[model samples]
Target: MSQIRLYDTTLRDGTQAEDISFLVADKVRIAEMLDDLGIHYIEGGWPGSNPKDIAFFKEIRNISLKQAKIAAFGSTRRARVKPEDDDNIRTLIQAEPDTITIFGKSWDFHVREALRISLEQNLELINDSLVYLKQHVGEVIYDAEHFFDGYKANPAYALQTLKAAADADVDCIVLCDTNGGSLPFEIADIIDDVRKHISTPLGIHAHNDSECAVANSLTAVEHGAVHVQGTINGFGERCGNANLCSIAPALTLKMNRPCMTEDQLRQLRIASRTVYELANLVPNKHQPYVGNSAFAHKGGVHVSAIQRHPETYEHIRPEKVGNLTRVLVSDLSGRSNILAKAEQFNIDLDSKDPVTQEILETIKNLENQGFQFEGAEASFELMMRRALGTLRHFFSVLGFRVIDTKRHGDDNPLSEATIQVKVGGKIEHTAAEGRGPVNALDHALRKALEKFYPQLKQMKLLDYKVRVLPAGRGTASITRVLIESGDKNSRWGTVGVSDNIIDASYQALIDAIQYKLVQDYAADKKE
Candidate 1:
């Protein structure tokens, strides 16, 4: 299969996403991650756009990369300036990239209206920008902005625009769906038409307004496109750009034309996660290759078949995409789910054991009352242990109160919470301030517990998430909390469910701490 180049714009277009922002350091870290994932080209940013991109380019040089060449994305020289003198072109040159992609007007309307230049002047910018960039970089990719629409409106002008860049010896001419509203059939038709005219290699840049970005990009490649441009996790303007996560897999796994290295396919999800985490936005759960929910199974019948044979329900092996299969526990769970969920905790259960039946019974009752064990693994373990009489509590919650004391001079915005507890034949009290009463209460609870087991400090809350089940069911219904925690290398998860948010969170928190202590105790026992 021919090698296709992947141009990642997570730093440039991804940052343009609504409500998405990443610090310079965040951009650098994600770049390194993409490099490690073996992506060929990482469009670091449009340094000519703003100071953030400037700072990103400068600071990122200090870090080491694995297999990615930096590319700077920008437009061709302005309508009135020489390509070499244009600030955008010069900035793209100075950014010191191995490659530069500059978009030029492919539409007559953009030439007459947007650039306010004669079609000839616009064509001059395309050729001159490519020539200048070729002098500064090893590769120059020219994007034909709105090429599909332009081709439909005026095929001669659009083909002429690409002819100019091809004559300038640009490495790739990328057909951009600038408006993002083009259909896949239109993309396929125009790319075939353009291919017949231009000898230069074709590339694709698609947007997702009609939700056809991925489809259009794939269609282009099927016809003869060589380069693909996208952002990690589909982060971009409006509905976002074509998602490289989907594109890479489609090209490599589905089409057998890998745009990147073989190893890149393995670290794909990790790469997606690194970008989302850096942006501080939760990764989409249904995102095709990398999502947490991608391979998750909740149905009892599905879990049983998977237990007997994995091929019954799984489409592609979860590990094929760097994700693991998850057997979720819910109120709809049956024996298979309980057994599978227990295995995740390394707990062995005998089918005929009385305690096994007791555990399932307890789960059903709690779930009927409003518990979602899938989110609260720790709580499930605690319940299982209680069934087998192996669970033990260090202390019990006597009372937790938030005193509405006058906001001190620098009092916390959230209320001050104090926790009182009975332990070791005596009552202990502690207080702390946090962003919220639950946070304060957690600190105080941990503070109190540390007196008994100092090892509790090694524990940390890695993730905390809450959801109200069957919303509009009123406040007295079920609330669920999922908590994932770790010491350093090992991460364990737990779930808690209750009618109250505070209660659900507290249950999940305690389960997390207890699970950590259990692991610590086991490690010490081995020692």
Candidate 2:
């Protein structure tokens, strides 16, 4: 089997995305993560462009990487300047990365319009830049910027650019679909033609403008390209770059190309999520291979089929990518969905038990009344435990009141919540102020219960979302509240529904607290 080199450009090209900007420390952490994922090259940002990237290259030298070589990215030397005289080239060498990757104009139009340089001048820039960098850096890579579009417009000139890099004896020549508009067939044909003129090893850098980045990348590998460049989760400028999260698994499991070991492949999901979390961005649940819903089954028929054979609906096992098959419960759920979920929760539930039917009926009815359990599995689990008569009451809510007052001159409203709760034989009343009614209620509830169960202090409400159901019009519509809560160990979701938004929020809040107490109680018993 042929080995494919995986080059990750998340620190450099990925930050060009509008939604992504990493601190110097964030870049180092992600580079370490990429090294752990068995990537061959990690492209640190351009040292000449930003101070943050320069700091990153300096800080990263302190940490020991296992196998991945850090590559610094920049453009070729300026048109009229010598390679040794260019500030960009000087800074790249000072960064002291193991490898240096510099891009030059491949398209004749860009040569004339973008760079305002003669065609031959651009060739000299590419050749001289690599020759100079090769003396300072251990290895050098040449990125043929806009190579696909350049090849399509002027194939002769595009091949000449690769020839210049080859003449410099650069380590590799990467053809870039910079505009990201090239099709897979076009990439295959262009690469096939380029191989006739250039004997250098080839790599691919693709963007997702036309949604063909992943397909084009794989097609390049199929056509004999040995190196692949992409960002995690396809994050980049405009439409983004090819997603290594999807590409790595495809190369390993589907194409018989081994870019990483099986154990490293299992960290694909973790790597994808870690980048998203560090960037303070939400993970795309529908993203391929590493997404939350990649192997999720919701329909009754699909769940039933997957229960017998998962391959019926799934292309590959989720565990291969560090993700697991998830059975979501909803109005469309069948006995198989319930049984699958019961097994997931480690609940001993019999398929034929009357309680099973009762839980199924309750789910369907509640869903009809503006409740969604797919995002609130903690609430679903609590409901199941209640039906089995195994759930312990942590605390009971006696009453709660929220007051929102807006002064005539003040723009901000003052919200206060007073709540009373009884824990066994003791009753506690508390009042708290917050930015909103829900916040005040949450504070008051915690104040009332933290004395009884101090472990509740560790739990935090992470996210809160409210959706208005179509059951009624405008202000009369029913609302559903989904609350995401987490401690240091794990996170879970709970939901509630009611006509009044505050009442619905209260229901979800109560479930969130009860779920945490139950988890603590179970942990204590196990200990």
Candidate 3:
């Protein structure tokens, strides 16, 4: 099988996504994980674009990478300036990377309109910039800006642009679908034409404006693309860039080519989630292979068929990409789903028993109460485990109170929360102040428990979301809160519901802390 080079731009273009940005520390963490995943090329950042990216390159040098070469990205040398004197070129060289990628216009329209340069001069720029980059780096890749559109407009000139990079001895000529509107067949035809025109190794870089980035990229690979450039999670400008999460698996498993090895395939989901988490964005629940719902079954017939033959509905096993399969219980669930879900909770469910009827009725009631078991599987599992007597809840709250006050000049209000609780024949009292009344409640709850469970220190609330049901909008209100918490090795999600928003927040907070303690206690006993 061929080993197509996989180039990841999750740190560069991926961070540019609107309302999504990464800290330098998070970028380093992602880069190290990608290196461990065996990606051939990781475009760390455009060191010349911003100070944060530059700092990332500096800090990454201290870490040891096993198999990935970090590439510094930049545009070609500035017009009417020598490559040696150009700041962009100098920054790329100063980054001290093994490979440098530069993009220059190949479309005549862009040359005339965007760059305001003659077509022949644009050709010289493409060749000269690549030739100059080759002198400073072991590998130089020339990205033919708008190569697909250029091919449709001036096929001869576009072919000449590739030839220029070839004569200049660029290691790879990556045909970019810059505007990202080309169809798959069109991309395939362009790839075939470009491959026939140049003897040099070919690469493909696709964007997602047409929502066909993955298809177009794979089509290019089917034709003759030996290298693929994409950002993890499809993050980039506008619609986004080609997603490496989908592409890597397609090449390695579907196409029978080894863009990444089997081990790398295992880390694909982890890499995708890491990027999403660092960008402070909620992960797409249906993002191809790595999403939470990728292999989930909710309907009666689908779940039953999946139980008989997973291949009937599942293209690939969820566990293959570091994710778990879910047998979702909804209004459409049948006895098979109930049994499967019960078995997952270590319960032997008998459809003939009244208890089974009771469980299904409870699910129906909770679903009516706006409890979505599909996204809140943890809550469902907890219910199933409780019904089966497998769950051992640590303790229950006897009472709690908050003394919160607002100051005139201070922006933050003065808040203090105290918890009075009795657990296992012992009473524990604790007081703590927090950023807000809700925060004060959380801090005091955790503080009281920390005395008994030291494992609470490792549990950090990664995310919190709240919603007020429209039906309960009057004096009485029903609120729901979801808490997603993480530790060193595991991430768990829990949900809470109550009439009072404070009560709902407290419920989730309790679950968040207890879940961590349970996991740590379980791990210790196993050891």
Candidate achieving higher TM-score, 1 or 3: 1
Among all windows of ten consecutive residues in candidate 3, which has the lowest summed lDDT?
370-379
Q: Tens digits of per-residue lDDT for model 2 on 1-527? A: 45899999999999999978999889989999999999999999899998999999999999999999999999999988898899999999999999999999999999999999899988998999999999998999999999999988998898898999999999999999999999999999999988888888999999999999999999999999999999999999999999999999999999999899999999999999999999999899999999999999999899999989999999999999999999999999999899999999889999999999999999999998988998999999999999999999888999999999998775899999999999999999999999899999999999999999899999999999999988648898999999999999889999989989999999999999999988888888999
Expressed as tens digits, the lDDT of each residue in 83-125 for candidate 3 is 8889999999899887898888888888899989888888787
RMSD of 2: 1.0
**What is the lDDT, from 0 to 100, of the residue 336 in candidate 3?**
76
TM-score of each: 0.90, 0.99, 0.90
**Residue pairs clashing, model 3:** none
lDDT measured at residue 329 in model 3 versus the true structure, 0 to 100: 92
Candidate order, TM-score descending: 2, 1, 3
Which ten residues in a row are the worst by lDDT in model 2? 468-477
Runs of candidate 2 exceeding 4 Å displacement:
none
Displacement of the residue 402 alpha carbon in candidate 1, Å: 4.7
RMSD of each: 3.0, 1.0, 2.9
Query: Candidate 1 — what's its lDDT?
Result: 0.83
